[model samples]
Target: MDRQTLDMEGARRGEISSASLQMGEDTIAVQCIATMSVESMEFSPWETATNKRAQSLYASFFVINLFFGLMALAWGGLFPGNGSSFIALVIGGVLTLLGFVLGIRAAMMARRMKRRQPYYRLVIGASDGRRIPLVDNNRDVLMRIRDVVRHKMDSGDREIRGDFDLDLDLVNLNLPTEAQKAQTLSRGPDIVPKSRQRETEVEAATAETESEVLFDQDAEIIRDAS
Candidate 1:
């Protein structure tokens, strides 16, 4: 059989393995659905006690705070006047603070999700997609996936090539680079050095481009690495 047929057949028969190595550039915390049973889950050592504890805490806090915030907003709005206004203010303030905290947490979650789902769930004929994780530790993998999924992010590209749908949505898909020369006309000729500024701009522009990865594998995005 030809290579494509072999891959398809292998994927269908559950004998398929990685054909080539790929790096993931970005990730999102998805409600990652795999076929593992609860019976099987009880045995995996990788599901650490710490991770489960943290997830449980995060879930509990999210629900509790959400309930309180909604309750405050609903109950506080019922009253009127300066004294009542004071009560409403407190409720509003609490809710607002909660919202701000949640927003920050959401951002953090997105960041973490990106890291966790470094690769994707491969679904050749949908025996249920297995979580095919990225092999490389390099950050560029996610950068690639972000660019690919930006267009049809919501459906996770369900419409684009069904076989590749999950793979495409699988964040960290690095895009190919362009050969075109970048040409932009600024207001005036060179004045200040602005070396750092220029470099930042270049990085930003490249980040917007197909490849979008400006930093090398060694350049750090997450600073507090232990």
Candidate 2:
């Protein structure tokens, strides 16, 4: 199969070979994969439909109760039927209060439903106990990668290459500490420019000469003591 570049730290300039999965600068051998799974999370279609129906019911209930409450209050106020009128007024007030409460609840539920979004997560477990979790908004892309990995592991393919544009920010992997960062900086550049080759060589030679001089001075001191 064709090799794909993954803008990842471990893969050569984000390039992945068939034998391993590159995560930043670390490689996870395909053969050592013990478990892999993809999970999708979203509001179920049935649940969504049911929610809509319930919202509508609440709205209908609110309107019906509110209308009846107003009518009862109007009858009690206009006709002045004494005891019967008092009971009507009490019932009307209760219905109106209940309607208002239900209306508010339906409004809140609608707002929450509007904000919901689908999420997909892929988790892979290695034999060495490393867990790789990949989360994405797109289900198809996540599933495709999972399928490819499964195929390679089962078929014993030597080459696994694919073009993957994954958001690095979504990955919650361990990051280097300040000490590691300082050590890396002290190590200097891995590849020096050709133009600086002579300067680099001169610097190396000068360092070696200084080390030798220090060694000679130590030896002379030891001889004097003897």
Judged by lDDT, which candidate is best? 2
Q: In model 2, which regions exceed 4 Å deviation? A: 1-47, 118-226
TM-score of each: 0.26, 0.38
Q: What is the lDDT of candidate 2?
A: 0.69
Tens-place lDDT per residue, model 1, 114-186, is 3322222222111345443322222343334333333333444433221122223333232222212222243
Query: Worst 10-residue stretch by lDDT in candidate 2?
Result: 1-10
lDDT for position 14 in model 1: 13
Instruction: Give Cα distance to truth, residue 14, candidate 1, Å.
Output: 35
Candidate 1 residue spans exceeding 4 A from truth:
1-48, 103-226
